[model samples]
Target: MRIRSNTGKIASVLIVVLSLLVTIPVAYAGDADALAATLSSGDRADADKVRDAGRKPAEVVTFLGVASGMTVIDLIAASGYYTEVLSVAVGEKGKVYAQNGAFVLKMREGANKNDNKELHRMTKAQAVKSVTDAGFEIVAEGEMLRNSEDDRAAYVFAEGMRGNTDRFVLKSRKP
Candidate 1:
């Protein structure tokens, strides 16, 4: 019974993953160092660098349809991981609104909150349902956006990003 249940869970997860793949578009096409290079950019913080392996920042941002000059809201900015990535992706003119969940907000009210002030360069606010209600449709949401490791575009520049040869695809959508 346990074996059967585990298999069922795996199958269900696979179904969700496959559905995400169908909806999300690739961010890297004929591009080479461009995609990986952006992820590995020195502009990113050292802390963010360590998280790259697990978070797959490049793939995640691209999947969200993030581009230079986008006004993005990092719904849950826990220590600004994705917020930092969005900052770089959006460029100076563009903006990132970093909002923490209720727990994080309550924690921030504590005493040890040192002056890690750069986080404020981004606006702080929760993005309520208003934007989506105003005609913005969410393009994609998932843990991983790349269709497959063997896919040509997903792993092409992974080495440049640190021995990660995951090609990336760039489905045309205006930046």
Candidate 2:
């Protein structure tokens, strides 16, 4: 009877120790609050308003499965609006490519040059800087659709209302 009791106590202690070991990794993985705070700080005022108005950055980030060490591509990242937010979500080990189509340059070249120029001015370097400032290395700029599949981004944020609505489309490797 004493032997059985001793064995039961050892099993209980083992279970408790095993549970603590399992939970420690999950606790240390990431802090959502810290990430959110970083996002709110670097984000623009209007973008914050837009985020507050309808979109939830944290939710969107989670839905996209963004982690600490993944690469993302922002399609037609106008004015680096979502770039700032994505940089914060992906963290230091992650990267973001803020791409623009040729249409942006072409449109900026003609009659609407003044307005388009301002748009490009705000978006160009700032987009790259945002990720770099967040401790990510920025890749070369250009269109994403033209890139090879391996060089392609893991996630794509398509701006405007035409494609994929307001949500980001995520691409994952098949197991």
lDDT (Cα, 0-100) at 97 in candidate 2:
72
What tens-digit string does per-residue lDDT give for candidate 2 at 43-107? Answer: 36854645533445554454344555566666555566566666666566767677655553343
TM-score of each: 0.45, 0.41
Candidate 2 stretches with Cα past 4 Å from truth are 1-34, 43-50, 108-175
Model 1 poorest 10 in a row by lDDT? 119-128
lDDT of 1 by residue, 5-115 (tens): 122122222212222222223343223235558768667777778768755766655554566555656654657776777666666666677765564555433323433
What TM-score does candidate 1 get on C-alpha atoms? 0.45
Q: What lDDT does each candidate get? A: 0.44, 0.40
